[model samples]
Target: MPHAIKLYVRYVDAINRRIGRVVMYMIFAMMGILLYSSITKTFFLPSLWTLETAQFFMVGYFILGGAYSLQLGAHVRMDLLYGSWRDSTKAWVDLFTVLFLIFYLCILLYGGYSSTEYAIQYGERSYSSWRPYMAPIKIIMCIGIFLMLLQAIAEFFKDIAKLRGSEL
Candidate 1:
């Protein structure tokens, strides 16, 4: 690989790793909040904000952790046919799949950006009693899609390296 490409890949790998760690910490924090909320609700009947907070954390967990899941190759895939393919065939299949995902995520990023912008402009709020600002969640959706795009690019290059018998 060229020096610049190698540097780019290294940078992406570092970001992915850091994000993965943050996701782990967020999961733990969410778990703790859920436990606390459950206890409070059971013993003291906590305010609606507790439930809303929990829901918000859950949403954040899923959206923010999506890229980390992809980095770990933990995303769902039907491998019934893919698992049986030869190395070269699998490489081509993976490359095509990555290309498709890139295009799909590009569309999502565009749409998400427009939606978030509109939401922010209108000052949208959640319908729940807490009425938290909805724009942040919409923004999170865009960030998640952007991260997925980055991961897709990394995976594409990794696969290409594998197919070419080069170390990534």
Candidate 2:
């Protein structure tokens, strides 16, 4: 592989790794919020913000961890035939299919950007009683999708290298 491509892969992988590690802790935050919700509902007036806040944390956790999941090959796949394929054969298939992933992510990112723009323009807020501003989470969603797109491209390059009997 060329030096620049190698560097790109390394950089994307590094960023995702760091972000994933940080995002992993968000599950605990979500759990804490839920626990507080349970406690509050049992003993006192229910908090409107807890449920919505927990939901936002869950969304952030899943979205932000996506690239790292891909990097780790932790995403699900139908393995009826795939599990038996040779490594090079798998690489070829992955290279071809990654194009579809790239295309889909492109569409998703575009839509996410449009929605985010609308949210910012209108100062959108969730419909919940808490009515939190939507821009921050929408922006985070866009960033996560963009990072996933970049990681997909890096995976494509890695597949190419693998087909050539090299690893990136």
Error of 1 at 9 (Å): 1.7
Instruction: After the best TM-score superposition of candidate 1, give how far the Cα of residue 100 lies from its true spot, in angstroms.
Output: 1.1
lDDT of 1 by residue, 65-123 (tens): 77778878889988899788898888788888999999998999999999999999999
lDDT of 1: 0.82
Q: Estimate the TM-score of every prediction.
A: 0.89, 0.99
Q: Model 1 RMSD to the real structure? A: 1.7
Error of 1 at 131 (Å): 0.5
| lDDT assessment of candidate 2 | 0.97
**Lowest lDDT 10-mer window, candidate 1?**
46-55
* Model 2: ten consecutive residues of lowest lDDT: 70-79
Q: Where does candidate 1 stray beyond 4 Å?
A: none
- Over 1-168, each residue of candidate 2 has an lDDT whose tens digit, in order, gives 999999999999999999999999999999999999999999999999999999999999999999999999999988999999999999999999999999999999999999999999999999988999999999999999999999999999999999999999
Clashes of each: 0, 0
